[model samples]
Target chain A: MSGLIKSSLARKVVMALSGLFLVVFLTQHFVINFTSVIAPETFNEWSHFMGYNPLVQFVLQPILIGGVVIHFIMGFVLEIQNKKARGIGYAKYNGGANAPWTSRNMIITGAVVLAFLGLHFYDFWVHEMDYKYVSGLAEDPTRYHEETVEKFAPFWRTVIYVISFVLLSMHLWHGFNSSFQTMGVNNKYSPAIKTITKLFSVIIPLGFIFIALYHHLNPITH
Target chain B: MKLFLKIWRQANANSKGKFTEYTLDGIEGDMSFLEMLDILNEDLIAKSEEPVEFDHDCREGICGMCSLQINGEPHGPDRGVTTCQLHMRRFSDGDTIVIEPFRAKAFPVIKDLIVDRSAFDRIQQAGGYVSVNTSGNTIDANAIPIEKENADNAFNAAACIGCGACVAACKNASAMLFTSAKVSQYALLPQGQVEATDRVMSMVKQMDLEGFGNCTNTGACEVECPKGISLENIARMNREYYAASIKG
Candidate 1:
């Protein structure tokens, strides 16, 4: 609603909800990507299904894209408004004394992650679109495994991917738990929730890094 | 103890400000931060120079009248104490202390080290209250029982003195903590339930209108708050506001 957009708290609720939605998507994406290293056949099968299925390609993909766009746009809106709130900057702001760097520098981490998203889309999404839509190629279920493995074959790409995942880790380190707080989730289980969010922030990014390295090291043999 | 002081000086709200440095000697460690400032003022008065202006009243921590960003921190790097309660002993001899007013667009500087905090009063006026009969027909205090934990939490939330330190401490100059404390103090009690829905809605709207930044859950406000107001108040306010929006 227009009224919701006008309220600062409502805007944050939008950020929290959209961010949580992306987290769900990230979890599923991580699971499927992990299968590429553990079970190539399973990865190919699932990737094929996701790529071709009308429900996923038509419905979920557009929604996922919308979520990403909304999150980033709202993030920028909030950042600009926040900057305006402090009309005059402090001469010496020792922000480190109270808040963590990850928490304070979310925009920096988020920008890095956004840049990585551009590269990630170019590497995979754009390629997939070109393959399926532009070129009108016949379906090759097994091609996914080889194609994914080969993408990481380049040392430079792998290094970039690894660095992006590190930045993503820092972004999630603050954001994942922060979403819950924004949603007003304070209770006896809050401590446990925080622990789980922290763990997920670390483990998921580490998992992605591991997958990237694994493929880079063990590219498909000729 | 001798110290170097860099204090922000401004002629008025419209005038540009700059930090003017002063060196003072023979200050006792037992003297409060304000006492040291008083000594500096005395020297400036004798020299026929403009004295550094700051806000202070009651000289006690409870008034919430004194505000100073000492050494880039609210209340001079002390925990759970206002500027008036901070002693010079916290600093080493020959230390350079930087004193500036709390900076926020919503809190404009009225003079050196005194920003207008009427923005908070406006937020409070928006709805930080509960309607009750005060016409000699008030309900009995013991008529209704409240849970002990809720009472304790409410009391803790009420500890906020509206010092604007949380605003000074937040990187974004967000007033979420201060506003949340006021909301929580009432939202926890039975009396507040009658207008709970309207209270949160209008207060939050007013807060946004005041041009305060949104909360990012950085927890800096909690760390720097002299009253030790918990971040739980903010979480509670978020819950309150969400519930109100849904109810509408």
Candidate 2:
């Protein structure tokens, strides 16, 4: 296992597997978040269950955090090593001539996504922790709807969320199918997988953007 | 055509390098890029000055001996050709061409436009082979039947010239394409089955030890390869490596 972890190929496999895990988490998170736009009651119930349920709070949430930490740490480690690989810089490297911006600039996109996660955790996770664990607030299933909507009421926050989503879209554009490639998935289904990943990259972020905008524009007036 | 050239110059591996500028006039469109360089060298030798040094052998694209990062692209602006095959017509009159050796931690600049690519040889030495007895006990290669697609792909993977263009073109200087091509060639053949697990594990271990960057799958290597080696070989190697690790 130590030998496996030491190999560059193994390191890449770790990145790919961790990244794919995050993608799965993102899809689930998107599904839950989208409910706030169309079904506030459903959103409140689901959010309440996730907040109070021992399985989610104690088990899955920690695993999710672990995934995020591993992904980012490994990303930084790989990026630094990769930089060292090109010991002397090229006087003029035309990287855009061959590869797409999305493929070549994953580090940039991934960094932005990491920054966005900081803000996201601050806005929601921190608040949830304070509300439930720190203050020891009594369970209120309906409170989730108002709390979520109010967080997006600020125009600046909404704009930041939207911009972050765009960068997240760019990250997924290369990362989604790339994970499959790293897993050594090359077969008859590859073309179909590529198409699906491309579509998902665009659509999921758009859905998140829509949720952010919808809450910002339709804040409760009472 | 007349061209202004910015060529890298260095005395030895331990010495510093810099771009030395030169101008050549009356270059014909039919002259290959290397031929133009030959004329410049002739002029320099006539003046009793040291001519620029670059690597080349066959002058044809077959031998991977030729390597040059011309005008920011490996093997010049033309696609699917080496510097020796790149023609002067690719550039216009008065165009400035920048020539530098392939840059990678694994490929140190030896002198001028020549880089020491013996790192590739070391990686090859690690496990890039099929172990077969030769003392009147070798099985006929034709005895094992391979699928048409697998055979074609193995042949394609075998075409990699070990020219470090994939490393030069990659932003990370990753040698995944070259290594993967080598792995895939043997991985697809029946003779390679016995040692497939060990071959992959050993080669990948050697590749990592060489200090080459990890592959990010940017696909630059595929685009810049003179032979147009496909990215599928990389995916195949990834699969092979993972399976090998699991087997171990």
Candidate 3:
């Protein structure tokens, strides 16, 4: 653990592992969200079930939240430590012909996503969880998760979701392959692994964005 | 050949700075990058505008003193060459070259394109040196029979001239390659093995104390490093740290 603490790569491994866990969770989350575009009724039911389900409330909630918390904390910590290890050299030289930009700015990208998540929760999760603080919603207890319909009702909201999803996708594009390398999985299959990871990164975020946009353009509930 | 130059000009670290443009009229393609800068400086002196202040001493590329980020690429469009060694042949006539100081929090802009890179010297002082005192060579040279491979690798690692180019080229401004090279130079040899654990720890600690960025392992430092230090040194440092952390 001391060695791990001292070494920059060890810190990176922690960040990558936690981040990979969150990426997997995000894909699962998009699967649940994408259902909104295909079948509103099923989506609403699923969303409602997710909110009130005892299993999720007791078990999955803590696990998912923990993963995100760990990923975020580890990321910032690694960034801080890495910054300390850096130099102040000037001039040019050879190399690094094949590095993606996102890989370099993961911390900045993460901070953006974290802020977006806070707003996202207030937009949907806070309302759906039916906390008593929502002043106008006390009168209508029956309309809770159905607020997702209202949430994506505006064109700008859909636009925001698309932009946020783009950032998320770009973040994952660098992050997925980085996680593999962090785990000491650098080898012949690294390229194939990176390609597949990028595809998943793009498709999953786009899936969420499509659903958000579809709901805004053609609402089934309204 | 002719190229427009937007050189960074500053009186000193405390002074205000700006980009001052100059067009070299009669430049030969064979003139080196620093030579082109000298021509511009001569013109600047002729105009009585303070000549562009850049850090350069041994134009031979060995001193690591000539540091500049030319045309957004360090050392200007070349792979694996110092600024002084960079030739004007890389640029075409009428090209507008944007010259700027190497950007990093640790590398404070001293004047023009030259920044204070003495932070590297400080980090090295923290533990980069071997502790053994040479009292007219206390030990015989042949006592330490380093494998030919290890000696060659150490030499490669030792070739780093403390130039800040690697830091400038990196987006995050990671200095892993630099730190690792210094660490690996000593870590690979038996003479350096005695204090390896302490050396790695202190150096890495001092590294964090200075504000720099993390290595994403994008390999940019290796690419831009004039010495072409391997990432293997970093791996070696990691192992050394891991072993030390566990033992000590």
Candidate 4:
């Protein structure tokens, strides 16, 4: 049992499973955020539920955080192990010959995504946490849309959000189908899976970028 | 043709290694890559210097013994051929070739271009064989009717010569292609069913214990393998391993 987790393939399995979980979470997060553009009232209601629901706050949020932490930690661990496996660096390595640039530079893209998450936590989650725990303020059930718009109203913050979504798209471009392949899902339907992953990679981030742009360009009127 | 060569020179596993340059002339375009090295070795012997030691046998590319990293490739610049099979016509006159040993923490340099590839032997010994009894009571070959595709895939997996090119080609020094080939060959055939679970588990465990890196699906192993092993075998191995884990 211990051997299963310690093996290299098993480590990859952990990475793939955790990555898939995060991808699902991203989809749900995107849907909720997208609601802000079409139906602000529904978006606020759902946001209040996610923010204050005991099950979501106490249970799902911790699991989501754990997934992010494990994915990041395992990625770095594998990268270090890979680096150490090649004690002597090659004088000339043609990495582009067999792999995409995104695949080869996963650690770089992943690190940038992690940095963006830090900003994301600071902007929204930290405020929510302080409001609930430290300030002990009564929850305003209607400020969800206003808060989101205010966060993106800053030009620098909007720019950062836009750039982070682009980087996230690049990361997903490789990571989406790669996680499936690692889980041994490569078969006759793999090409279809790859196509869907490509589309998802682009569309989801584009949706996020659109939300950010909409919020930034047209801030909510008081 | 005249050629300039920069080759790695290492004394032993623990010793520091560096590249030493040499020049040779009157080389024919039809000569093989190994033959070019042979000519240089003869010159070194005549000069009373220690001739560079490299591994080769059955120079026809079957032995899997000839290993060299030429111009940053496992079997030189040419695809689909071992170093012993690479002809000199691939290069032009006055060209300089850089050669080095296949580098990996699991494959330590013995001397010059030769590495200790006994790690592969150990991984194979872990579970790369069937446990059939040989007391003349074996079932007839025709008794088991396998699909043509299964037979072909098994044969393809069986074609792996344990050359370690897959390891040399991977940026992370992963042996996934080689290990998967072994696992797939057995998993695809009925005779390998009895110990399939144990075989996949033990072999994978041993492979990890050997200090090899993980596969990131780079696909360089397939591109660089002389035998043209496919990465599909890796997916198959993963499936087998997952099934085994669930059964356990």
- By how many angstroms RMSD does model 2 differ from the true structure? 1.1
Clash pairs for candidate 2: none
Q: By DockQ, who's the top model here?
A: 2
- Candidate with the larger DockQ of 1 and 3: 1
Native-contact fraction for each model? 0.71, 0.76, 0.32, 0.58
lDDT tens digits, residue span A96-215, model 3: 343556766677778878878888978866765656345544444234336676788888878878888888888888888767755545456877987898799889888888877777
lDDT of every predicted structure (CA atoms): 0.92, 0.91, 0.75, 0.91
What would the per-residue lDDT of candidate 4 be over residues B1-248, giving only the tens digit for each residue?
99999999998888999999999999999999999999999999999988999999999988899998888888887888999999999999999999999989999999999999999999899999998878899878669999999999999999988889899889889999999999999999999999999999989988988888989877788999999999889999999988887777
Candidate 4 Cα outliers beyond 4 Å, as residue runs? B135-137
True-vs-predicted CA distance for residue B187, candidate 2, Å = 0.8
**Candidate 3: residue A166 Cα off by (Å):** 2.0
Pitting candidate 1 against candidate 4, the one with the higher DockQ is 1
Worst 10 residues of 4 chain B by lDDT: B133-142
Show where candidate 1 strays beyond 4 Å: A1-3
In model 4, which residue pairs have backbone atoms overlapping below 3 Å?
none
Name the candidate that leads on lDDT. 1
Where does the lowest 10-residue lDDT sum fall in candidate 2 chain B? B239-248
Q: Which candidate would rank higher by lDDT, 1 or 3?
A: 1
DockQ category of candidate 2:
medium
Local accuracy of candidate 2 as per-residue lDDT tens digits, B23-99: 99999999998899999999999999998888999998999999999889888777798889999888899999899
Residue clash pairs of candidate 1: none
Give the candidates in order of TM-score, highest first.
1, 2, 4, 3
